[model samples]
Target chain A: METKIKEIIKQVKKGDQSAFEDVVTFYQNKVYQICFRVIGNAHEAEDLAQETFIRAYVNIHSFDDKRKFSTWLYRIATNISIDRIRKKKPDYFLDAEVKGTDGLDMYSQLPAEQLLPEEEVESLELQSYIQQEIMQLPTKYRSVIALRFVDELSLAEISEILSIPVGTVKTRIHRGREALRKRLRRV
Target chain B: MSCNKQFINLMHKYLDGELTRTDENLLRSHLHSCQSCQKHFHELKRTTTLLKSSSELQPSSNFTEKVMASLPKEKKRVGYMRWFKAHPVITAAAIFFIFMFSSVFSAWDQDSQLSVSKDKNLIIQEDTVIVPEGVTVDGDLVVKNGNLKIDGSVNGNVVIINGEHLMASAGEISGEIEQVNQVFEWMWYHIKDITKNLFAFTNK
Candidate 1:
């Protein structure tokens, strides 16, 4: 699968327009999901997803074959989404302080081990709540969390995509998870 | 209390399975005994699982087509200016070399005392006229039907008729250099020279 992806990327790099369409077809859903999760809006996610592919197409020559193509695509997607979010809500991070139990920030709080009830209804509710809380996370935290959990990207891959250190990625993920745990606890 | 804080700190790494075997064992034992830490671990695990299990959102229909439509018709070719912008040092060096070459060529042309005359009608005389170094002609030096070469100094004007004028770098002319190779050019030069003397007389 990796070799096939590399082959398609090679074709795309060679100005094979049809091959680019195929590339888009293969990665559109994943790209859209990442954008949607980060942006939390269907319409804006679609626009940003389309923008990501268009940017990738225009700058395809810069794509280094040494790394994964998906990583490059994710980097474009996340950057576009982050830029859009920053533009739309200039003060987004200013209000990033999530209310926590006691005086501590929600990210500093450890999760409590209440076994989630294994019922379909409760599980669905928990899923919805988790999604909502994930959206509420600050853009930085939300980005790493979505890339790690939603996209199943490794810490190293997230680091490469975000152009940050793996340590920073881990810290964001840890904080994001704790933030979600706090939100879930309130529910 | 410090031990509990330490365990809390390691909880994320433990859940990630990034812990060393001994640390993993120690964390496991701590979790087993500490209800709060164990509960926290379970919640973290469940939250991660829920996040991973969330279904992907499908984009609107024709997402691929929209992206394809929006892409540029063709890749932009890197123009010379863009390349220059990318390699400013190389461009600067190239421009410097060109300027240097032209400067050197001009200096050589001046030093050689070549036929610097612009009038194509001017004829070259077989006999070479040389104003030797240290020779200074004070009054107007008019040459008719002969080449005039100046390697020293002329304090007054030099006028040539039907001949070429060559001036070396060491030559210095304090006044005008005029060449008239045709009958009409000679007439015009005289008329202009007479007009100039009239204007000087009028001014005086």
Candidate 2:
């Protein structure tokens, strides 16, 4: 897979624009997941995810060949996400319906009559509550926590993606977990 | 229900699924005996499990297509201009260096025809410049792509580029005589000329 991604990146570097679509298709979910978790908004996450790819495409030459492409991509995703929230307006968090604010929010686009399993519905609510607690964390801790648990990335990988030391990543993840526990205690 | 502080660190490792089996057993035994650690472990577990079970959220179906649709077209020419604009100092330095080297190299090849800086009493033969035996050349004499056979005195420096010199037994030069052939020396000469010009400008 690494070789395949490197080949795709090589093609992108060689000025094959269509080759970049493969890169976008391949990493979109992971990038979107990182952006969504960090930004806490589906619509804006999609926007930022697109921005991440566009930025990646524009700066493809600047992508260092030595580093993992995914790490570089996530770096862009996380930076865009953190930057978005830092330049915060209070309404930036995706409500159940920040309807028509940005077009076709996935949350609103769900079929109205489609039934979900009871267990799944309860679990999704639990997920939503957890997401709220995640949002409450200081933004620094929030990203590491999301990268750790949501992305299920290793501390070393998180360090590379965030350009921080492994020890600092561990400290943030530990502190972030404690913050979540405190917030969860409230509900 | 006091707990060992090390156990708290172990609890974090356990949550990360990083605890060695032996340490895990130790933690398990401690948690079983200690109510405070047990409660704390559960709270930590709840938070971690909640985060770990993050609902795999997918972007809308057209997410990729939308990303594809909106990607700034892979810019070709403008990108260079954009790069140049973004790093003004580097770009300026690069252009200056390139201009200097290019003009130097281009000038190097064209200097095969002989040229001299001062012509007063300086005799020019096809590829030989003669400082006539009896007449005094007034100032500095520069000869390029030729030979200088000097028989008269020069009051200032004599610089020869890609050339040779022959001095008569009576020939006199009051200032330094330098023969510059290598590109490096040419660059140094350029630097000297620039600094001299700058010095003159500053004095003015």
Candidate 3:
């Protein structure tokens, strides 16, 4: 399946618009999720997602076939978000490129019925609490946490995205979670 | 068999289904006895479940429409060559590299041509100066009444005032000076000769 995508990518690099669209359709959701996790917003994620595909289009010729297409795409998205964050002081998710009034904020109230069962609600509350605590973490920890959990990418994939070694990725995820658990304890 | 650090580590892998049987049994034994670890495990389980159950945000119903709208009119193929050439930075870099290469080669060709011309002039007036091979004249080679023949290369200028000059196969002159046959009476000839000889001797 991936080999087929690889072939499609080669065709896309040859200036095939249909192939490019295929690439976009294949990776849009994953790219959006990554942008959302990194930027912490939906609108930005959507915009960044589109931007990632545009960038991939621009630099497709430079894409080496030895690496996984997904890995390459993730690297592009991660870098774009990181660069955007460094240049701008963002109040919301970096992925939120689009400014929409209807978009949900992290603090928006959940409907009563939609809430977890009483015991589970406490856990959900604790998870949300943990997320809030995570937001207070340094960018390094926050990035690792979001990549590890929210994006659900492998440690190796996260390492590639961050341009760090796998060991560093592992350590970051470990320490980031530990920090979250510690913060949760305080609450 | 409690919520010790080891069990904590095990829980991380356990949640990911990475624990071996022995490690799994160890964690299970620890969990059975330890309330805190059990609670922590439950919390982890709950969190992951909640995360999974959380509603995902899809792009708007017209999301694909919006995306397609933002894109240019769909074409089956694009002229990549024109696109690549239109990139000012890349084009500038390429032009810069080409200019540098041409400049370097031009210098080399000029130097080689200059040497070839000088060597030819040395052969043309071979009656006056005998320049030995393997000697290089560092400056100009000029033959007038005096003969200059080279079996070796010269490292300095070669000038024959009213003489013939011969540059053998190994002879080379790299610098510049004047070659004149008609001795127009002037106060400058002696001074120029002194300066040229001084420079030539120093180079040797």
Q: Which is the leading candidate under TM-score?
A: 1
Q: Can you tell me which runs of candidate 3 are displaced by over 4 Å?
A: A90-134, A179-187, B52-55, B65-204
**Off by more than 4 A, model 2:** A89-124, A185-187, B75-204
Task: Give one digit per residue, the lDDT tens place, for model 1 in A68-151.
Answer: 899999999999999998788856334355565321344333233343355224444654556656766667887888788766
Q: What is the DockQ of candidate 3?
A: 0.17
Candidate 2 residue-wise lDDT at B21: 95
Clashes of each: 5, 0, 52
Q: Output the better candidate (1/2) by TM-score.
A: 1
The TM-score obtained for chain B by all candidates, in the order given, is: 0.36, 0.62, 0.36
Candidate topping lDDT = 2
Per-chain TM-score of candidate 1, chain B: 0.36
- Candidate 1 vs candidate 2: which has greater DockQ? 1
lDDT of each: 0.75, 0.79, 0.61
Task: Report the lDDT tens digits of candidate 2 across residue range B1-204.
Answer: 376789989999987778999999999999898888888889998888777775577777887888778877756686587678789999999999999889988888776788999887688888889888777777788898888888877888899987887764478888989888888887788778788999999999
Q: Judged by DockQ cut-offs, is candidate 1 incorrect, acceptable, medium or high?
A: acceptable
Error of 3 at B102 (Å): 25
Give me the runs in candidate 1 sitting further than 4 Å from their true place: A93-128, B1-3, B75-204
Per-residue lDDT for A45-140 in model 2, tens only?
898999999999989989878778888888898999989887875643432334554222333344423334652454446656667556555566
- Residue A118, model 3, lDDT: 51
